[model samples]
Target: MRQFYVYILAKHRHGALYVGVTNDLIRRVHEHREGLAPGFTKRYGVKLLVYFEQHATAATAIQREKTMKRWPRAWKIRTIERTNPTWADLYEEICR
Candidate 1:
């Protein structure tokens, strides 16, 4: 089975947030952390992986990403806090 990820990255607690969808979660997050990814994420330094959801299909992942991007900031914060109250960099966990 294939996997898709809808993810949120942040600069820090209550900081700028970015929403994206990818087939390779670890590599994509690594790119963001290293500032290898261009545009808003690199510009704003939103490299902390605070939230993510997996889907079986790219279409669902893309839909989730779009929905998240449209969410109010508070809602986004709540969503992150729900899974990562400390806003830990989930990269290591996934890498393991």
Candidate 2:
């Protein structure tokens, strides 16, 4: 089945937060980390993959991304830590 992802990346010290959706989570995160993907994420250096949710449908993932984007900072952090207590780089965990 095809999959989609809604992911959040952060700069060191929570300097900036970036929320995005993608079909290939690994590739997308790699792009941000490598500074290959241009725009806000690269500009702010939001490279740590803090959180992500997967869905069978792209529409579902998109909806989740929209919801996350609207969430307050406290709520967003709570959501992230619900799965990632240390706000660790989840790229390896999820990719594995």
Among the numbered candidates, top TM-score falls to 1
Q: Which regions in candidate 2 have their CA more than 4 angstroms from the true location?
A: none
Per-residue lDDT, model 1, residue 69, is 91
lDDT for each residue of candidate 1 in 1-96, tens digit (9 for 90 to 100) = 989999999999998999999999999999999899999999999998988899999998998899989999999999999989999988889999
| Model 1 stretches with alpha carbons more than 4 Å out | none
lDDT of 1: 0.93
Error of 1 at 12 (Å): 0.4
Please, what are the lDDT tens digits per residue for candidate 2 over residues 1-96? Answer: 889999989895345888899999999999999999999988888899998888999899999999989999888787877887888888888678
> lDDT of each model, Cα atoms only?
0.93, 0.88
- In lDDT terms, how accurate is model 2? 0.88
Name the lDDT value of residue 34 in candidate 1. Answer: 89
